[model samples]
Target: MGEGRLFESIGRALGLPPEAVARFGVDGPAEAAVLVETALRASGFRTDVTLYIDASRARALTSVEVATRVAPLLGEEVLVSPPADDPAVATSWFLITPGGERFRAREASPGNDSDCVEIDRASLRPG
Candidate 1:
């Protein structure tokens, strides 16, 4: 799952105010996923993601997204997930790529889904 602390981390890295993020009506953890995606993509990197849906928590016809974390830690890819047991959980992601290909990846997880945002992980971190 996308940890709120991660969002806070992205906020600082992306140079966005947490209040502006808070205004998005992202109350629980689900919305936090979207917020994390938006902030990361807006930071100007090609991002990609895969979303998993539990179907039980979705209120409307929601799409999939990436459950975000530090992803892959040392690779170009990262995996994101939240506990399936969490009620306000997010299981999908809006993947962003340098080529503008925003779609889901053909993968499934009963947990935090996967990365919906792609950063130059190789450039951003060490192996």
Candidate 2:
């Protein structure tokens, strides 16, 4: 799928508005997308979504910036991880809802050999 469409699909899964998702690709396109499902927490289980954007063409915004900007729209408290100095390493960041739903974001290239857990598109829908 095209980058725009991919972002839109991700936005819907995250329950984000189209405008908010558009900000992700303002400077560059997202090269890859992945959705992961982990064991249920004490609160509940939420699908974790990650997208890799071309850093060279994207803005240097931090995870805090992105989470804070999107939190208000979702009416939830979003937390972020500490920044990483190296670009080659995965800087983990998470968006957690009041209900304990967690969303993680990471920076990586599409060609990276890291194994990503894949799920069908239908799984993106809210359960």
Candidate 3:
């Protein structure tokens, strides 16, 4: 799915239209955090959401986040599984950067549970 479509889908699930999503206030990181927190909760995530502004990738201040309800593993030595939600409709995690850029997280390797490579920006495509 395209970015617009992805967020539109998410917006629908969130009962937030495109205008509402944009109205979450995106002028700064504080605003971004509010936007993200609201989205995650509406998506049925009960775990803590952590946000990070990563400039290490492609020299851009990307809003990298991890939904503990989704990708909970913190070490390569542990094995994990996705929550009991359909990945087809509900995304495991979300990435939103400046410029209203958004992406859905996908596993780098489907069966490989180990490593920090599980969820990667490189794994993100249009959606």
Candidate 4:
């Protein structure tokens, strides 16, 4: 490959597209995350994602199962209810914070920014 062509290929591999990325807030971050996940997959970059969750068993059949079921199809590592002290994971999970009308719904059951759980995968407990 020509040196110039090699550089262009590298840029593409590294995700330097001309189109600016879109950002969403905490609300409906799922949809945005899905987009980012798609881009990452297209670019061949493996990623691990986390989400904010609670200890309530009641929520198990709800988002918990829903997100887990969604991950394999999307090909992502997902976690829920991460540590509040870790800023890296804390920031990682908020892939999209939907705004306007979407943000309105997010406010109702706000996902904790501090928690570091995976958004679309289930946690496997060790015996």
Candidate 4 total steric clashes = 19
| 1-127 per-residue lDDT for model 3 (tens digits) | 1334433433343334443333233463342211432222221222232223222321232223222111222211111233345464343545443333445665454454332334555766543
TM-score list, all predictions: 0.23, 0.34, 0.25, 0.22
CA lDDT, every model vs. true structure = 0.34, 0.42, 0.34, 0.28
Best candidate, lDDT-wise? 2
lDDT of 2 by residue, 5-31 (tens): 545543554555444444333453333
Ranking under TM-score, best-scoring first? 2, 3, 1, 4
- What TM-score quantifies how close candidate 2 is to the native fold? 0.34
lDDT of 1 by residue, 62-98 (tens): 2212222223222223433333554424633333332
> Quick one: best TM-score, which candidate?
2
Q: List candidate 3 segments past 4 Å from native.
A: 23-127
In model 3, what is the error at residue 29, expressed in angstroms?
10
* lDDT for position 90 in model 2: 51
What stretches of model 2 exceed 4 Å from their correct place?
A: 1-47, 85-127
Model 1 RMSD in Å is 13.5
Give, for candidate 3, the lowest lDDT window spanning 10 residues. 70-79
How much lDDT does candidate 4 score? 0.28
| Candidate 4, poorest ten consecutive residues by summed lDDT | 98-107
